[model samples]
Target: MRTDSGLRLEADPRPPRALPPVPSAIQGDTPLSRPKKKKPRTKNTLGSASSEGLAQAPVHRPSEGSELPAKEPAEHPEEAPIQRRQRKTRLPLELETSFTQKKASNSSLLRNENGIHVEPPEEAVTQKPRRKTKKTQPAEIQYANELGVEDEDIITDEQSSPEQQSIFTAPTGISQPVGKVFVEKSRRFQAADRSELIKTTENAEVFVDVKLSWTTRDVALTVHRAFRMIGLFSHGFLAGCAVWNIVFIYVLAGDQLSNLSNLLQQYKTLAYPFQSLLYLLLALSTVSTFDRIDFAKTSVAIRNFLALDPTALASFLYFTALTLSLSQQMTSDRIHLYTPSSVNGSLWAAGVEEQVLQPWIVVNLVVALLVGLSWLFLSYWPGMDLSEELMFSSDVEEYPEKDKGLKASS
Candidate 1:
């Protein structure tokens, strides 16, 4: 409408608009329909100022018939600190129904809050019973008749009386079964318990399978055979020495003491060969002992000797010969010496010293060198035999064997 003279003409007053109908489903309160609003942050100072303004500002409620707020709403700024919260739109029946169905679902839950459904455990399954054994009348009279027989006779004719009662049937408080009489006797013979006793099916026959089978004779035979191999080794050396020792002791000494003179008389026969043989046996035994030493007292030397080659046996023997030679020289030299010329022509005439001394020294020196060389060969490798040769050359000069017979009579 146009206004004249700067005065506007007012339009006629308009009737109030009718509100849209609220949905029936949206009418009820629901958790999903609750209001959702953005929180507005305000400075603490401005918030307090607003609060004071609110307290000072007048609040006017709407008239009784009015559907609007009781008081006129406060004017809000474009970006007001106080927010008017908008209520959430209520969901349709289909969405609410889906929600209700999800709540009722047990797929993602343990159970309903109200209760849980449970089925009773299945009853124990029944099984068919086994058939009962048939019962036969016991022959008590037959047992009584057998019991009447002497106890000793029962052993002789064990099965002759049939229908005998089981040992368990005896009324008295007997510890053993009555039927095991022969078994008990057998156990006594076996020197064992009842479990060890055996019974024969026929005629209560009993026999003892004694464990006393390992007799001394059998063990001795086994031991002898085992040691026989060791004996062979020892006996071989003995055989070789026997003749040598005997001849050196008897024939050689006999001839040497017969009579010879001068430097020749200084010589005597020596039993170095026999001494070597004895030492060899000792070495072999030591080797065997090394291998056979009981668990309690084994030594490293014994272990080494056992593993040593058989050829080493000869080396051991040779070393033994050298040791015996050295020992004999030391022992023989300790004996009191005599010059035959110092005695009467008759007493010195026998030429005992001339018969004995020089030859023995020569032989002993030779044996010692041989043994020492052998020991060196075994003890040190490469240039080992050279050491022995040098020693031999040096010691050999001590013996002068130009004479044949030179042993004094003992």
Candidate 2:
């Protein structure tokens, strides 16, 4: 078109093209900038490939407008048709978070100096809530600074050798619980006080006092060994008593006594006393023995005390009953005896009543009661059990001081 001035200006009559849609500054990320995900790998066989080929391009094609039969889409097929994926939504940070969106809705919009809308940061708030909290200052450090502690005085880790540096030590006693009291490992075992043991090294968990030596462990082991020896001896003694009780019963109750000579018949004297002596021996024995050993219950040796032997109880009860039986039989079944007078008539004579069950049977029963009950009570004594536990804990496996002392000595 020519202008009125006859300046031929051929301008395109079409209106100027509209500018592209302006991108928002608040837009978080573009689809292209977002990380691409890798597809999982899969193996294929010729059969699958051929099946897919046959399914897609069917041998007999359906007539126009007729739908293809329902078939699964190929995982990856050759000569694939072009397909466009729907554009992914890349919402801005402001829109992605519901919290930020709510806040932005509630808060007035902020504008840059250029009068352009600028989205506030996700965490940005118009006003922050004032929280009342006590602000503590290092008063000690400040005091030290006022005192003008020099760099030399403020010793750092680099300033000292490892031997001089403080170590982490747990509190053993009330007197020193606050600071890290680094105690050197005294290759020598004992300290004057229990607190000293704990302060010396942190590994020793128990604090126990001893009578003579700081070597509580050695004392305990020695004690256990002594008890073990005593138990072994007592066990043998008690077993002997039990067996002899049966023999004693056989001699007294049966006719075996008549077969032996008078001097050998003195065996009756030894056997009868052994019945009562069995209880005496058992009283000393059971407490020394251990029923079971368990380290879980205690780091020490035995957790359970030895129980009373059933054989001892049975043997004693049977013997006591036998003595009572003979006494009763002598009283009820004794023969009334008579002797003819030297010159004239028949005269009355002493019979077997006194010979069989004497007044001493009562004494025997009383002694039996005392010994048996005492044995039972001592076997289950809580105090004795407790003492054993304490001893084992202090001395059984490793008393820290004794263990260290031996090592040092060795």
Model 1 lDDT per residue over 1-410, tens place: 11110010000110110111222222221212332311121121122323322432221111111332222132223312121211101111111112223334333211211123231222101000000000111123212222222221112322322233344433222222243223235446323332223222212322222325656556754664466356345534443453344444434435654533432233222233345455666455334322332212335334534776332443454445545554564335322233356555433334355445555545554554443343333334321122223333434555545322243322
Per TM-score, the best of the predicted structures is 2
lDDT for 168 (candidate 1): 44
- Compose the digit string of candidate 2's lDDT tens values, residues 1-410: 11111100000110010011212211112212222420110011111322332332321123101321122114222211211010101111111112222233433312221223343343122111100000121223222222221221122322223343235422212121222223346674432443443444332222322334457567766777677567546655555555454454445534633432231234334533454465456554544433223223443332232233333343344345345434433222221222222324433222332344234334334434533443444345322433455446644556787888999999
Write down the lDDT that model 1 would get.
0.31
Task: Output the TM-score of candidate 1.
Answer: 0.20
Where does candidate 2 stray beyond 4 Å? 1-214, 255-268, 271-280, 289-391, 394-410
| Per-prediction TM-score to the true structure, in the order listed | 0.20, 0.23
Error of 1 at 304 (Å): 20
Total backbone collisions for each predicted model: 18, 1
Angstrom error at residue 320, model 1: 11
lDDT of 2 at 201: 36
